[model samples]
Structure formats: C-alpha cells, structure tokens
Target: MKALLTKLAFPILNALEKSEGSYEYSPSHRTILKVMGFLFMVISAVGLYFSMKIEQWAGLFPVILFAGIGILCWIVAFLGSDKAVSKLWRNRNE
Candidate 1:
C-alpha cells in the first residue's frame, strides 16, 4: 500500500516542486502565473454561480474547493517573488 501511494504521489510532488522552481522572478513567468490565477478565479466564480442557482448545498463543496485553489494561486502569484511585486509597483507609479 505504501509503495502504491508513493507511486501515486511522486508525480504530483515532482510537478509541484518543478513549478515552484520555475518562479524565477521573471516578468514573463509572473505574467503567466497571474493569468493562470485569474483564470482559476473566474472558474471559481462560475462554479459559485451555478451552485447558487441550483440551490444544491452539496455543490458548494466543489465551489469552495475551487475558490480555495483560486485563492492559493493568487497568493502564490502575488507572494512568490518580492522582485515581481516591486516591479509591478514601480510600473504603476510610472
């Protein structure tokens, strides 16, 4: 069982580590992460709307799950690199 679980988890762990490593404070990488985060937020919004419309309380679980993921993505995109945040602030001031 442990071996099976390890096999299942290894790829996910590897992907996450690889993605974390890709955050190199580059403008392009920041833009991509921000865009992905926004997309996740949009998906979460849609999920929320459908959940409310259908009045399925059970459906809220998935909505909340997506919202959490969206929030996480946004947090990572914003907080992953101090340099990216500083660059954004500098651009805004100009």
Candidate 2:
C-alpha cells in the first residue's frame, strides 16, 4: 500500500527526494507535520460542509486550498523520507 501511494505521488516526491543537500532531522518535525496535515484536512472538511450547506460556490476556494495543502502535508509526512521533511521545512544545511 505504501509503495502504491509513493508511486501515485511520484510527481510531488520527485523533486524533494532528488535534491542534493545535507539536512537536520527531528522526530518532532514529522510528528508536527502529521498533526498539521490532520488539522488542515479538518478545516477542509468543514469548508466543504459549509459550502454545501450554504450553497455557495465561493466557499470552495478555501476548501480546495486547505484540501490541497492537507493532501500535500499528508503525502510528505507519510510518504517522504526525513530528508524530504527537512527540505519542506527549508532546513537545508548552510
């Protein structure tokens, strides 16, 4: 299942995974990333619910935004390596 997901998200993972650089790693970073992803997903769900309830197409903007961010966060947090997480955090070695 993880392999299949990694394949599915190849486009997003490619650049980050391929970057050449040293990075600082922390277990907490990944933990916080997962937490933020879950929160963004929750926000997206609420946005979707409100959009449907209010019957307003404009609300979909935030829904899509949050959902996209949430999905990205989830992909990186779960599928990416420690290096990828560090890259996302912009913690490349100086």
Candidate 3:
C-alpha cells in the first residue's frame, strides 16, 4: 500500500516541479485564471449585497471595510497577473 501511494504521489510532485519551471503561461492556466477572476468578482458582489441587505451602508466602518476588501482584491489581481518573465535579467551575452 505504501509503495503504491508513493508511486502515485511521485508523478504529481514531478509535474508540479515542471510547472514551476515554465515561463510562458499555458492556455489551461489562463482559463483557470479567468474562472478565478469571475469568482472574485462574484464574491465582491455578494459583499455589496450583504451590506445593502443589512441597511448598514450609512455606517462609515462598514462602507469602508467591505468596499475596501473588493478594492484590495482587484489590486492584488493586477499586481500578480501572469506574464512571461523578461530574459534581460540573465547574462545572455556571457
């Protein structure tokens, strides 16, 4: 049982390592990112829905906190977006 489990796990580990080495974004990965982005948008919408439902939009803290989370998620998405790493950093001339 132990040997079979190890055999199954080894391929997953190797694939993870190979994925980490890739520079160009794969199509499937892009699709996944799109799905994640949609999910986050929905999450923000839900937060707004709750704020409105509770009728606490007039409060300063609630307005700031929920909207602030949505804004933060957008900022993080922009900063951490997938892109090809530039080769200029490497000493290619050497």
Candidate 4:
C-alpha cells in the first residue's frame, strides 16, 4: 500500500519539483521548450483565427492542433530539456 502510494505520489512530487524553475535547467533545452511552447501558442492562435474566419470545423482544428502541440511540449519538457542543458554545460566547463 505504501509502495503504491509512493509510486503515484512520486510522479506528482516530481512534477512539482520540476516546476520550481530554481534549478536552472540547461539553457538550450529551456530555449527549445520555450520555442516549442511559443510556436504551439502561435499556431493555435492562427488556427483559431482561421477557424473563426472560416467554418466551425476548421476553427476547431486549431484548438486540437494547439492542444496536441502543448501536450508534446509538456512531454518533451518533462522527459528532457534541462538534463540535456546541464550535460552540455558540464562538458563545456570541463
């Protein structure tokens, strides 16, 4: 029971821990995440505009696209970015 609780809570804790921004993850990785996030927002905005200007179905497409990209960014951000950055720094400083 404790193990199960820990397993579930660990992911949550990791999420909260990762969010602190105090750790200063690798700049390149952070940049990539930021760019992807920005692109996702921009694409979504474009999609929304097109959708509004066109058909309801078309407008919804941007919403889906943005959500998908946002999800992709979250996944990439969680799995990577900071680690890659720190590794690069370690190499350069050494």
Candidate 5:
C-alpha cells in the first residue's frame, strides 16, 4: 500500500526527497507535520461548508488552497522518505 501511495505521489515526493546537503531532522517533525495537515484539512472542510451555506463561490479559493496544502502535508508525512520530511521542514540552521 505504501509503495502504491508513493508511486501515486511521486511528483511531490521526488521534489523533496532529493538531498543536496546535510539537514537536521527529528521524529517530532513528522508528528507535527501530520497534525498540521489534519488542521488544514479541517479548515478546508469548514471553508467548504461555509461556502455552500453562504452560496459564495469566492470561498472556494481558500477551500482549494487549504485542501491542496493539507494533501501535500499528508502525502509527505506518510508516503515521503525521511529526506523528504527534512526538506519540507527546510534547513533551519543554514
């Protein structure tokens, strides 16, 4: 299943998994990333609900934005390698 998911999100994974230098990583980074993803997903859901309730198409922008970000977070948090997670977190000390 993981292999299949990794294949499906190859584009995103490929970009982050490429390592050029040393990076700092911690287990908590992945946990925090997953939490952030879940929060973003919740925000997206709320935006979608409000958009429908208000009949305002403009709200779809945020909905899409949050959803895309959330999905990216989830994909990286789960399917991506440690290097990818480190990349996503970026080289803080650099």
Candidate 6:
C-alpha cells in the first residue's frame, strides 16, 4: 500500500524537487503551496462550472481530483512546509 501510494505520488514529489532546483533562490514553501493551492482551487471552480453547464458528469472527475490534490497541498503547507523546505535545501546542499 505504501509503495503504491509512493508510486502515485512520485510525479508530484519529483515536480516539487525539480522546482527547488529551478529557482535561483529558495522559495518559501508555504507561500508556494498556498499560491498553488489557490490556483488549483480556481481551476477546480472553473472546471466544475463548465461541467455543470455542459451537464457532463465525467468532467467532475478531474475537477474533484485537482481539488483534492490542492487541498492536500494546502494541508501540507500548513503542517509541514518547514520540514519540506529543509529537506529540499538539504538535498540541494548535498
């Protein structure tokens, strides 16, 4: 189960890791997460609106998935951004 989850999350984790390297300076992980969460929420809202307008239930899947991921990001930001940032820095310095 853990391995399955890790496999599922690998893409997100890799993206976050790569983002750290792409920046010339380290970013505040909390801020980054918050901004990303906000953007995702906006996308979710738009997607949902369009789906409803079209009356297609299938469109809700992606919107719900993005919303769930966005909420998870926000939770991580609030609970562990410091730890995450430290890990990123440590990895970069190694």
Report residue 56 deviation for candidate 1 (angstroms).
0.8
Runs in model 6 with CA error above 4 Å?
1-27, 85-94
- What's the lDDT of the predicted structure labeled candidate 2? 0.92
True-structure RMSD, every candidate? 10.4, 0.8, 13.9, 8.8, 1.4, 6.7
After the best TM-score superposition of candidate 6, give how far the Cα of residue 55 lies from its true spot, in angstroms: 0.1
lDDT of 2 by residue, 12-50 (tens): 988787778588989898999999999999999999999
- In model 1, the runs with Cα more than 4 Å from the true position are 1-25, 82-94
Comparison by TM-score, 3 against 4, better one: 4
lDDT of each: 0.57, 0.92, 0.44, 0.57, 0.90, 0.66
TM-score versus the correct structure, for each prediction = 0.55, 0.95, 0.39, 0.46, 0.94, 0.60
- Candidate with the larger lDDT of 2 and 4: 2
Residue lDDT tens for model 4, 18-71: 442234455566567657777887888788777878767747866887967765
| Residue 54 in model 2: lDDT | 90
The residue-by-residue lDDT of candidate 1 on 40-74, one tens digit each, is 77887888888889887787787778777666555
RMSD of 1: 10.4
Better of 4 and 5 by lDDT: 5
If both were scored by TM-score, which would come out higher, candidate 1 or candidate 4?
1
Model 5, 29-87: lDDT tens digits are: 89989999999999999999999999999999999999999999999998887888999
lDDT of 3 by residue, 1-94 (tens): 6556445555433333333333554445545444565665666567667768887675545545655554433332333334311111111221
Name the top TM-score candidate: 2
Clashes of 5: 0
Better candidate by lDDT, 3 or 4: 4
Candidate 3 Cα misplacement greater than 4 A, ranges = 1-22, 58-94
